[model samples]
Target: MARIQTEHGGRNVQVDEYKGKKIEVATGYDARSDRWPVHVYIDGQKVSGQASADNMSEAFDYGFALAQREIEQQ
Candidate 1:
């Protein structure tokens, strides 16, 4: 597992191998409302969107799934 720090978002982001590709999961608070959002990036492309949630774990799960599904289609 690896971690990345993004100035805009993704608090303590985690990187891992998934389905023969490198998947990244990140969490950070939105500029407004202080809501934590999870974002997923694959191969430098943002496959998943920002998902706001109270817990980082749930958000990451959703974001990761979203990214994987999108990648499968392409």
Candidate 2:
């Protein structure tokens, strides 16, 4: 398992790789917000992209999709 620890929206968020894949197994949040921020990384390189929404679930869904797209592109 691999993990990337980064801060977003003043909150600490960690994206962990599961089964040795680029897909983030889980997203962590330590702050309160209707929207959650995501820190994306591809092949150990951090990707510059902002994904957020008023809904935390939607935000995470978008982030996960973005991550998957990035991984496929690489």
Candidate 3:
């Protein structure tokens, strides 16, 4: 898998390509909520249903899986 790091909305984003599709995972920590927010984008389009996790790694996992599922559905 090819991976790259970029920034989106002032947050660091990790991007991977799968099956010729670009999957971007952006994670951020919300101090007030005490949770990590994860956003997944496929081919530059944001996927629905945002997810949150207790840590960064888990957040990324959720985002990656969400992106993969989106690509599979398409």
Candidate 4:
């Protein structure tokens, strides 16, 4: 079973575990770009892709979903 853990700050972070592997979603505001940048990690390895959203909440959702898909496909 997996559960989500979230923390809020300058960088919003969410963490989960799937099949004993750790998945992390991090979102941060990019002032220069006026976008929220999202980063997804699985078991400490960063997934390669350009992910961004217009808002912090959306960024977190996108990141979490992306991470789940990556985990499922593996």
Candidate 5:
């Protein structure tokens, strides 16, 4: 449970751990509504994709699965 400072400033972003790897989750915002519109960041990359459900937990699962698949493939 730690945050790595990004160029985006000093926001305390959470980094999750999976299989000893670090994963980060971020949300997309609806500028007009100021609401997070279904998005997740994995290791600072947009990996949950655009068509994913608007759920944080689901996003986390997707991130973990994607990372695991890539690791196994390599």
Candidate 6:
């Protein structure tokens, strides 16, 4: 597993990839509310695009869980 970090506003957020399976983790901002957003993807497919958690760990976990659920469903 490799840990990837995406930086925004000079703050780096760590996102873990499972065996480098093309999982991408990125952050965005909600312009309307000025809130930070965390987005996760798998194989270039979006797993979750939501705003949650103040820390990277929880945000990444949410994305990872989403990926797991998607895999189980398929």
- Best prediction by lDDT: 4
Lowest lDDT 10-residue stretch of candidate 2: 21-30
lDDT of 2 by residue, 1-74 (tens): 34464544445455656335554422344356645566555556676866556554555566667777666676
Highest-TM-score candidate: 3
Backbone clash count for every predicted candidate, in the order shown: 1, 0, 0, 0, 0, 0
Rank candidates by TM-score, best first: 3, 4, 1, 6, 2, 5
lDDT of each residue in 1-74, candidate 3, tens digit only: 66677764447689999999988999877888999899888889989886899987788888888888788888
Against the reference, the lDDT scores of all candidates come to: 0.67, 0.56, 0.83, 0.84, 0.47, 0.60
Error of 6 at 26 (Å): 1.5
Residue 1, model 5: Cα distance from true site in angstroms: 13
TM-scores, each model vs. reference: 0.67, 0.49, 0.86, 0.83, 0.42, 0.53
TM-score of 1: 0.67
Off by over 4 Å in 2: 1-20, 25-35
Q: Each candidate's root-mean-square deviation in Å?
A: 3.8, 5.5, 2.1, 2.0, 5.4, 3.6
Model 4, residue 60: what's the lDDT? 72
lDDT for each residue of candidate 4 in 1-74, tens digit (9 for 90 to 100): 34365777787888888767888888888999999999999999999999899998798788878888888899
Worst ten-residue run, lDDT, model 4? 1-10
Kindly indicate the candidate among 4 and 5 with the higher lDDT: 4
- After TM-score superposition, what is the CA distance of residue 47 in candidate 2 from its true location, in Å? 1.5
Candidate 5's error at 11, in angstroms?
A: 8.7
Model 2 vs. true fold: TM: 0.49
Residue 64 shift from truth in candidate 3, angstroms: 0.6
Displacement of residue 34 (Cα, Å) in model 3 is 0.4
Which of the two candidates, 2 or 6, achieves a greater lDDT against the reference?
Answer: 6
